[model samples]
Target: MSGESAKGQKSYTNALLRLENITKAFGNTKVLNGVSLTVGAGEFLTLLGSSGCGKTTTLRIIAGLERPDSGRVFLEERDITYSEPNKRDVNTVFQNYALFPHMNVESNVGYSLRIRSVNKVEIKQRVADALRLTRMDEYAKRMPTELSGGQMQRVAIARAIINRPKLLLLDEPLGALDLQLRRRMQIELKRLQRELGIAFIYITHDQEEALNMSDRIAVIRGGLLEQTGGAAEIYDAPRTSYVARFVGSANILRGVSALSSLLPNEIIAVRGENIVMEPYSEQSRGLKGVVTDKRFAGGMLRISARLNQSGAEVVSSRHGIDSPLTPGQSVSVSWDAASEIVVKDNDTGEVS
Candidate 1:
């Protein structure tokens, strides 16, 4: 399900957008601190982070909705750090569809061109093309109030793309949809991006969404970029404990000297799926632990255990519904040495 390798090959020699040492703050609280990133032409890059982590702020800055207190923004090699939103070659699709309730889909999609006094015939033709690209051509006659959430979202996308901007910024555009609809939209959005061959800077807090749709993900934390890489790279080799635990469910093992040597501020991060758990015995070859909890999660069994020596809680996953693990059972928790990822404690500096 990862497009890391194929998407990673997209060239950045002709970068579409670049932010240099961007910094922003409101009143006394700094929201963004020295962030810099680039979006290659036609590449799908996702800015991922939890709410208020500055992902949205970064997006707004790119879209010209917010200005960075410091740093420069360039699009197609032209500095646009202070350019008016209307002058920038950028378009945005927000979580809310923002479609006019009084307008039909066709009118909404053509509004930007119409407002600019584009020829009527050209607006009509372009609107149709945009709607068809989004697979919503047949619904052009429908009013915004009459469309389903997904349909409305499609219309919003059509509207945003009708002008054919070089870079499209989507600010959690699918967040309002139901789970099933959201998943379907993810695929549709990626397909549309490829077909358009335009760069997309998508914003989302959903790690799964980022992994499934992004060529590269920029993990943001505390107003700064924590790490940025393809889906597989970020997942398999996170640079810090915060990224390891934030991007997915990682069990942070602290003070576990048996696994590897660590400083007082360092820790180990082992993914649940990478751990191997077995019934504990005198001859067991790993840390002894007692199962503290077990649950059947559809196709896999999730087991949580507490290591007897370090009192560290570890989670492991086993395929199938037949796992016989019980809460009170003793088990040996071990993982391949290669699977042990020694990461820096985010609060402290990087581990040497």
Candidate 2:
């Protein structure tokens, strides 16, 4: 949800990390062009997009793993564009976990302290504390080979948090896990992050994961950032056609906004779940539609229909009802007038 009131409050912008006019190129092809974004302190931010969209590159720039051709980076109001990875007060947990197979969990967790010449007593205490935070203390003596997938992730997180970095960068850290494990880890990760109070910059192509875990998400496409906002704001109030279609399943239809008073003049919108399929003559103020098809989708029944009055296609689903809805049923689909979002031409799918 947006951290502001409706009636269009001013957008919040107290950035913790700022990227100004960042540009990157591989030979002649530009990977990132004047890309800019800011991450708020203690907020879980997810940089989301398909491959080749520069989200990974942007994460790399923050980690000091990749240098940008142009622009400056500021972390906590301090310029750190040219700072080495070792000097930056941050830790990166990559998709691969990047843990050393040769090292035990405790050594891997305490490596940074050990390299800094921290006394053995201090390193032991810190590593033990970090392991306890991830609930991996029992696995401290085990090698990376002996740990389960979830246990390995915990170890990796333990390693990253051991040093108490000011920021944490997660690039598809949960991509490899099975569905059950990923779901479990996501909950654990979110809890741990909230407890630690360190800002997180996460990267992922999974929109659901981004929405589920992040305070806000940045959607990028073709090396350009399309939009950034909280999960509800972005999902319920998409700013672009790509965002609408990508974030969820949507039926895009073209119509004259001026002609249809009921249909949302806005771009693509999946039919809201709250819309009642049954018709009422007195209070029928929604889009005039006809039921075209309905199908059982696991626990819920999905209904696809077309607007008879406006000729627009609509896709909706009904859940929790054991009775089945018939096909080609007559229904006047309706939506709240105030809930209809107005998107720009570029943001809305083109008429063509």
Candidate 3:
């Protein structure tokens, strides 16, 4: 399970790749449990989850870096679960820009081509084409040490793409960069994937990255697939309590459903955000609470209010809102029932 395979080439499959019920374990720890997903041709799918949640294990399974204990994988409908890493039409770009310091940029990119016994002319052509696509053509003769983190990472990407793999696996490809560079690379990676027309299975713990880049997101929790949906679907209608708090800045509140409110309690979660906080309107049907804290972030004012019954504090940030009072101020907090996301834990039966 922990060994390297010799570099070799195989006939390229026309289909991208598909993973079905892939499960993996290490020692006594179960990493991936019954994970099933598909990466269509020319698509970008992201595996988003927190640390130790099996995102990385799933990526490794796709890359042929780790063999699943059960399930199967297919490229173009051809079974390849036992296929060698180099034989599969896939490549992975590690988080730590895996570039060779001794090798120049061109060598790094063309290394796989060399292993495949590609002719010198074809290798040179592919190296030039890949480098040009990543905007690193001029640095062909430069060594890995000669480039910055972002630049070297581009070299890593160029190296992966040069192989002309049908599927590209990116494990936090932009994780090493600073915030600004990471944002820039996110745009760059998306654009590059579009231009390549190849399937991308991206893995990351960052939800924002998943929202921004993925055509579809597969959320994993506790080694299980929680939910898979588009950005709007998962953010707006989270299937579980864990999902709502994980995807965005969620403000979970407690409220007993008033049946005659002209709206379903299910839709109450959406109405909580639009609740008017200005001078507490009398028409608002909300829990009375004390405002415990306030934070001014840029153009938005965040208010943390504690409910009277359970003393559970719900946070709401109002845009272009400035409060007239200080912290620990006494205020009757109210929110339209329509704006709240009514989440109930199945085990505890407590509304989140």
Candidate 4:
């Protein structure tokens, strides 16, 4: 999809949550600096950023776990900034499963309803429904210790959704699982969000996770929102160098005088897969470079080349099992002009 249409998808008539000028500081360190955002009802929005970028703090503020030093939080137009966590209609699932070892899966999932004095019949029905939604009905009698990490995560999600909150906050909930399991859980989580039809505010530093599952992605940097758009919009047209590099792998070409199309201050970012590398020939029209390294990455081969004129390293990916190019082999690198992305350099230098 084009960036324009991707951005247009964020215009919502019914906003479920709104954060206005939220700011929080811990002693001399300011964690959130006037961060503002909105979550639409039944939308899946992800807070994407590296560690210490205030994404987690933003999630906590919305959950009422951490009150903002300044600004207001509104849930369905109701002011809930100073409300207690339990008082608000929001639930959180942390990275650690944090399941009760003494309780079985059914008891853990139904604990919230039980504490509220819900009748046994209603509680049991709700618990059963939650387990079935999370595909953990078969494991209801199992304890936390007997279940795997993925199962424990499912239980945590089930517990969070048992009360049917208006919004759910997930703080890197898939960080504990292995690669294969994490990928599978990503699909499962998206499906669960769709089935529940509730707003989900997910936190993650992994760009792939954000791109795969989020309806919209908000990229945070230096305690500020750098960019917010759909996955394709963020990947195709990043507004700044920090965002371009953070969202995906890009060949950032800076100070390349050879490209006359770019302004003096602007830099170019090309995706590895968009770049084409071929063996050098006398009739070659692209930049001459030598292959510096090559490696096999599952389904694709990644080749790194160093330009002879500018001495800048470039990486290109091709779909194949092996490449004939070897280290020190002469090659030419080129890409379509439409593939080049011109982005502004980050002046703050606060992005990690």
Query: What is the C-alpha lDDT profile of model 3 across 93-159, one tens digit per residue?
Result: 9889889889999999999999989999999999999999999999999999999999999999999
Q: What tens-digit string does per-residue lDDT give for candidate 2 at 80-180?
A: 99899898988999778888989999999999999899999999999989999999989889999998878888888889877767789998999889988
TM-score of each: 0.92, 0.81, 0.85, 0.91
TM-score between candidate 4 and the true structure: 0.91
The order of the candidates by lDDT, greatest first, is 4, 1, 2, 3
Q: What ranges in model 3 sit over 4 Å off?
A: 1-15, 254-272, 275-284, 296-299, 342-352
Model 2, runs deviating above 4 Å: 1-14, 248-250, 256-270, 274-298, 305-313, 319-323, 326-336, 345-352
RMSD of each: 4.0, 5.7, 6.6, 4.2
lDDT of 2: 0.76
The true-versus-predicted C-alpha distance at residue 73 of model 1, in Å, is 0.8
- lDDT: the better of candidates 1 and 3: 1
- Residue 18 in model 4: lDDT: 95
Using TM-score as the measure, what is the rank order of every candidate, best first? 1, 4, 3, 2
Candidate 1: lDDT of 170?
Answer: 96
Residue-level lDDT of model 1, residues 236-325, one tens digit each, is 889889888878668788767636777766778989988889988899998999999988774688899999999988989754566767
